[model samples]
Target: MRNLDRRLIQVVPSRRQLEHQQLEFYSFVHFTVNTFTGKEWGDGSESPSIFNPVKFDAQQWVDAVKSAEMRGLILTCKHHDGFCLWPSKYTKHTVAYSPYKNGKGDIVKEVSDACRKAGIKFGVYLSPWDRNNPAYGSGKPYDDYFVNQLTELLTNYGEIFSVWFDGACGEGINGKKQVYDWERYYEVVRKLQPNACISVCGPDIRWCGNEAGYTRKSEWSVVPARTRETELIADKSQKEDNESFRQREISASDQDLGSREILRDETDLIWYPAEVNTSIRPGWFYHEEEDDKVRPLEELINIYLNSVGGNATFLLNIPPTKDGLFHENDVKRLKELGDFIRHAFAKNLLNDAELAVSSFMRGYGIDNVREDNYLKYFRTDDGITEAVIDITWENEQLIRYIVMKENINCSQRVESFRIEANLGEEYKTVYDGTVIGYKRIAPLTPLVTDKIRIRILDSRVAPTLSFIGVY
Candidate 1:
């Protein structure tokens, strides 16, 4: 038990963190002066006169997001270029000076209103590095200006789900680098929107180490508290995932982040889950030349199965064109992605499963996992870290996928597990995995079997499963 810190095993996600994890799939709306300039990072010299998306329709953006089964949209309120989507009284470089709506339209307000009206969550991405303001590298003054803009987004928007920030620091207009007030900015988000989860540079969510739709074969949610540091991850692969994709001091992306061996030295632990993000096109912003370069349907599906299914929420960026709408090519791909999700999850083969467990803890039994609702789950007695779950069907059935979810509310504990199917005469391992946090989606090689066995090889505490499903 030397590596098993009860304190670490006992760590749980806060209400807001738990709610954010369940979002599973969401959209990152990256629209700004960059879209028009065909630049990924805009220099602070663009004119607001050329920023109009005359045909811009926030509703269309929401519709595209909703159709793709995404539950929320995080719009880029401002980028490193220092242009504000909403008219901020603190800066003259905002949508207020744009020709759209005759210099009176607020893109932030329009998007937030559309999200609320569509019954989906709204979030904001406010870059910490502002390159336009003259006081950019002046320390406290820039932080103050940043906080003022942050406060405006949180208060003006009805209910913000996420306050996304990136660690993209560079020399500003004055040719000096900024020392960001990370703690101060976190406080403003906490005070204004207590329910919102501060993502990336903040505490609630961690970047999944890349923006290439890449995911770890086994993504773990519970990590040592210090792992969220930008300095440590920056020097290594784990450190370079955020801030406009900063180059890593090291080149490898696969790193052992959370394991019993890794956690033994840590006194503090946290449920800082990962958010996997990538763009639909080659770049974060729309460029007509890259129109045909939209990610293929199969690539998108693989990203979903690996990210959303691998203990991290998937954030796919679907940028708007210069005309203020999703490109037709991107829209077409979104529909395909939506249809694939609906058809794949329409029916749960587990409905026909007769579940039985080797042991149970008092009232917690097999029935808890029968319905993947996250309310109740199957748990074993203390010291029973290893157990077996038997699932059977009266008639032979072909199982294509097996999905498992841990009631992380109870704290993530299962360390390793494998699924076996009775194909002919004996049970054979079909899929194996580690760390099932909020959810884990595993696909089988397509087998016909009447029985499936789940072997929980190890866990931090008595293993618990909120839900086990077959699809």
Candidate 2:
């Protein structure tokens, strides 16, 4: 594949959004007041004195994350309990009132500094619901308080890559729900960190519709355009009278775009990618009882494949223990997962193989080209639907994974595909899958073969391939 240039067919991603998608894999640090309370959702009545971590080390946390091959870290600066990690002037119920460093510790500042020093990106997750704030249910006062805290984080921190918001709103201390001013919150993020992509309850990125670590089998990065109103309305209203509307929005947001032959709402097409977020353990916060329950190495790899390999960003939550460090078991598991991935994908078997396509267009015979800029096409006399590309290897080699990529700049075309390996002069089917969007890494059983062929079974148009590889 070489010397091919074409206009993008699908909705284009913003520079920030594209960079975010390229991150592929990252960890979410869910350390908060709940870390000490042993609760998933805290009611904000707990004493700040219980939040002391004597051996806290932000550098150690970042080092562990880097060792795991993750690109960045998203610190849960605040949760539904409204306990701020930083010493915000807005609330006395923060670390300022805690015993850590005699009320002089700032978790956000330390983590951000550690990230910058370690050369990985940093992000912030501030929950919209504040159960501790007395002014929460009072519209204008609560909005002002929330915005002021947001401004403190964005302005104080160096550069935040992503800003995360959850749909978890509950009744405040007054037993009345607080109406979050999401628009104003988004406005502040844009003004402070324009390069950051807002995930969930914001306009930039959409949730994968579940907390599980995998997306739909046929996940599509492109979906129907979302309006401002739809973007601001969190899913918390599902149990209220707006249940139908919430359900519809959720359905549309996570709609599987790979199964469609023709997107009828072409005019409304938008690049709203999904983010697969899941905890490293069954719970988001660290608990001593669940120390041995860290997600096994195999499960971590599977989660990576399903999320990052399935064309979606992955946010694996790795909660810090009460000691302000990753559990020894968690650190060991992350290292093992990273090592397995690095070794498994160390080299591509098809990088230098002799390549030929069934239907070559403009004398562009695929010579094992794997770069995204140089796309190889299979355009025939009668509008090519199905085409095969044969690769001749030097000798038999072990093949475990096959990575495929469509020229997504030209749109997601291939609907289904199959790969066959020539085993002793007899070709045998090894793998079959759907939707090769930006990238699709198909893991398969190790097979020894000297030659292999890939057949595109279905496509909306003559597909343009940017890469095809075996590892």
Best by TM-score: 1
Q: Best candidate, lDDT-wise?
A: 1
| Residue pairs of candidate 2 with colliding backbone atoms | none
TM of each candidate vs. truth = 0.95, 0.89
Tens digits of per-residue lDDT for model 1 on 161-183?
A: 99998777777999987888888
- lDDT of every model, 2 decimals: 0.86, 0.78
Report the poorest 10 consecutive residues by lDDT, candidate 2.
1-10
lDDT of 2 by residue, 1-471 (tens): 111101124455777877887788888998878889888778889789999988899998888888888999999998888999999999998999999999999999999999999999999999888889998788989999999999999999999999998766678999887777787898999999999999877778777776656567887766656532343446533222222332232355445553453345344666677788887887778888989888888888998888888878889889998888899898898889889878988898887677878875664446525654444543432356577988887877888998877656556667788999898789888988887776788998888888889998866546667777789
Residue ranges of candidate 2 with Cα displaced over 4 Å: 1-8, 226-233, 236-258, 265-267, 360-368, 372-386
